[model samples]
Target chain A: MSNPVSERGFEPARHAELALLLEVAGTPKPGNVDRRRDLSGLCFEHFLTGAVGSAAGLRLAEDGAPVGEAFETAVAGMSKQGGGNTQFGCLLLLVPLVKAAVAGDLSPEGATRAAEATTVDDAVSFYRAFEHVDVAVGDPPGDASDLDVRRGSEAESALRAEGLTLSDIMELSAERDANAREWTGGFARTFRAAESILNDEGPVTDRVARAFIDLLTEEPDTLVVTNHGEDVARDVMDRAASVSDLDEAETLAEEFVAEGINPGTTADIVCAATFVALERGVPL
Target chain B: MSNPVSERGFEPARHAELALLLEVAGTPKPGNVDRRRDLSGLCFEHFLTGAVGSAAGLRLAEDGAPVGEAFETAVAGMSKQGGGNTQFGCLLLLVPLVKAAVAGDLSPEGATRAAEATTVDDAVSFYRAFEHVDVAVGDPPGDASDLDVRRGSEAESALRAEGLTLSDIMELSAERDANAREWTGGFARTFRAAESILNDEGPVTDRVARAFIDLLTEEPDTLVVTNHGEDVARDVMDRAASVSDLDEAETLAEEFVAEGINPGTTADIVCAATFVALERGVPL
Candidate 1:
């Protein structure tokens, strides 16, 4: 009999969606929502619903839709279940990655190329997606206040007048947003983490968790920096660096959830890494 | 701005896939795998992977593929991750439900019509799926040995000679398999359970878990009956009937997982009900 995986063929859209699901399903990922724990406002089920809801946008990306349109659609679909912005940053990373995967190259260079090709319309779409969910973002630098995501569609005119492509906007935010940095820097961290995930042993979820801890240890999470300042973010990273195994991670997970310290950006990067790994033939 | 949900439109394929995800994510559902628990050899991540892998087949059903073909394809894809039959029975119910939903009627009657329309080729496909996963099935009756599912594709000639459509085969197994009975009985139990799920308040996952306990209280689970016999199945029902709230159910969940008593058939029915509820507008 023919191999069923080959018979079904490679589905970049499904892989992207599965990446979102698997990212949240990984247990003891420290601070973020996972299978075993939930934050006060966010639960595991919201992530599940968001992953399913995002399918349409993922399909659009695979079909070669504009990055901004796919990202906005994914955000809107993800917010449809009212989980309150479960995977916005993850979707930002995935849309281009999926498009690149569909174009027969799923490398970081391919993803960066896809992101670089986005137009001003894509920027408008990306901004409009802000209306769908209450995403927590740091205040825009004074010079870019007119293009703040919190301004939603109100920023569209400024975006158009500035002729800022989604990639251009991402470049502007690269220093503050880990997700945006991937767009500008060829997704280096995402690719590196994907390699780690592929090289790790045990169930894919466990591998994802280990990779997540490694990533958290490597850098202060941007979301934590946004919410709790650099000091707290550095402290969180130090705690992450101390976790050598799942049991220690589980203890940290409980403390993080209890203290309301969520390292969301690191989780988003893990989601992106998961897509890359799956595209590179990570089983399950 | 256009309503994003309307902009994306109704996606029965996605709804079916989400049902599979939601079914497994609902916590404390007695004995089966859920967000917080897993039976021996079947971790929660396996179900997550299985749900993602089954998307291609769910899409096939929505696109009007034959019931048996879609089901077998789903089973093949689900087994791709080596979950060892994480969702074989759930897929059996979802394939027809998705087909029905795609046809503009997601009611039990519509599901029945879809199931009844399956061809002999679908039966051959159904038998062939057995080669993919080691499903736990009771021994076939002495007279039906030639059509045994354990025989896999080797029984195709017998199925073709007998001119057995997938629905006809389901009819023969209806008395033994709750999943088969849905095909023969217009999915009465599935619809009733869906109504219960929709009526319950709180998180959709909590609703699913409560509805699961309700369903288990109403009848002895067919898989439990197959594995542990009628007496044990009845005892399970009694225990389920005593669960008045989530806390009680949590206690039972721990006990059930420890004892290795998985009420898989009830879980399958709940999965089917989840699809129906989602189609009928269950939020998240």
Candidate 2:
């Protein structure tokens, strides 16, 4: 896997997360699902599916089961988040990244091209192909339908039958805030696990982590630019900087792993760092 | 942790594909970096930082370097893929997501609340925060100035300095057709890794592979409701009846794992299915 820890630090939590997910994601013959990580508690997965129906405005039918409302209703279900709506928005962006991988959308050649592309557009496209799309497109923006309360409720219920909840959708309502930035238009994003770690949660501890962290510094620029050294340092720094204060260098390093780091960025960094170390035959 | 292989049978690969990213995101180290992965390539970070610059349009007088234009020109340098341009339209949506993550404008608590929302409208307020910025008061997306492009060929040269070659990037691009559903709007309709896996790739092997296959379906209903053997069987039978197949049961089970399952759907199904299985205490 790519190193998400490169700039931040190694996290066994990442491996733990992957192990946990991988352990459970197999077949029923393999084992039973635990409640803690199951539907009883809302995790990233439940959050996403609910977001999908919510985004699409799927409704219950006149019958006991729910029927889908207008696509607009569905979209409204996704885009018109009022208060606790994020599942759809997040799910919208992330599902496609997973799709990209399954579809062979992500090839070594493809990834390297993405790695080499100088333009943000191409990079964005490269990344886009890898985006989680059901969430991205299942419930598109602009879902406003002139429906009455009863109709909307039915639609909501239908979506619910699919286990699609309204609560997890990303409203993309940021579009309305006058205080928003130009990028606000793109504010609606989803959580597509990258190719290697589908539903791979957080990191735990491992050689990759301990090895990488032993290397960072407060000043990113001052570090040496060897393959593993430099990238690892920057990722560590970014992860370190993401949270509250860590006055000293020692504390900064500790917090990097403890609090963990952003899965996407940190995972990429750490994986690469480990690879570099292995490839270059770094003693550490 | 969810199940890749279900009790019903060997399900096809679903939209669980973050692992594919791991395959291609090779371990490369840029300069002055720390931590690990650098798997996605540092070039992306630079390109993104530059986009942030484009949005912010900040001009910092840094030495004699055209560093301000480093990313800008780099983006401009890429061929427009014979026709398409990434600067406008849907391509622009990511600006908000990336901007929020990098700038920390998207409050964590707000995001969490939104993720848990049931209605799109309900989640709108939380979603709005990423987009909501006070003109002068808000932290504007940082400009190119925030990017640390230096005044030497070394700075720019090092951006993509690695084992990666232009050919590698081109190869990646060509594969787009095999994997991408469309050149535009990528996964417009189906967005599951399982769907993508079956359509473009081929078969499901590992749980991770299965997850990717299932990710493309984009139907939360499948995940939430049909996760159990009964529903899985029924959904397959329904599809089989629609088609001309006889072994609909087996086919349906396999179809479920095909890439293109919705992430939200997959997440929910994995959670729900696993929850039930776990309740039964089935062991791996």
Tell me, by DockQ, which candidate is best.
Answer: 1
Docking category of candidate 2? incorrect
Count of backbone collisions in candidate 1: 0
Candidate 1: residue B21 Cα off by (Å) = 0.7
Model 2 — TM-score against the truth?
Answer: 0.19
Using all chains and alpha carbons, the TM-scores for the candidates as numbered come to: 0.93, 0.19
Residue B43 displacement in candidate 2 (angstroms): 35
Worst 10 residues of 1 chain B by lDDT: B1-10
Interface RMSD of each candidate, angstroms, one decimal: 4.8, 17.6
Q: Which stretches of candidate 2 lie over 4 Å from their true place?
A: A1-121, A127-206, A218-267, A277-284, B1-284
Reproduced native contacts, each prediction: 0.38, 0.00
Candidate 1's C-alpha runs over 4 A off are A1-10, B1-10
Local accuracy of candidate 1 as per-residue lDDT tens digits, A1-284: 23233232248898898899889988888888888787776888789888988988999998888988998989888986655779999999999999899888788788888988999999999999988888899999988789888889999999999999999999999999988999999999999999999998877889999999999998889999999999999999899988889999999998998888999999999999999998888865
Best by lDDT: 1
Clash count, one per candidate: 0, 215
lDDT of 2 by residue, B163-277 (tens): 2222222122222221111112222222233233333321111222233224323332332232243355345334534532223323433344342221223222222222122
List the lowest-lDDT window of 10 residues for candidate 2 chain A: A27-36
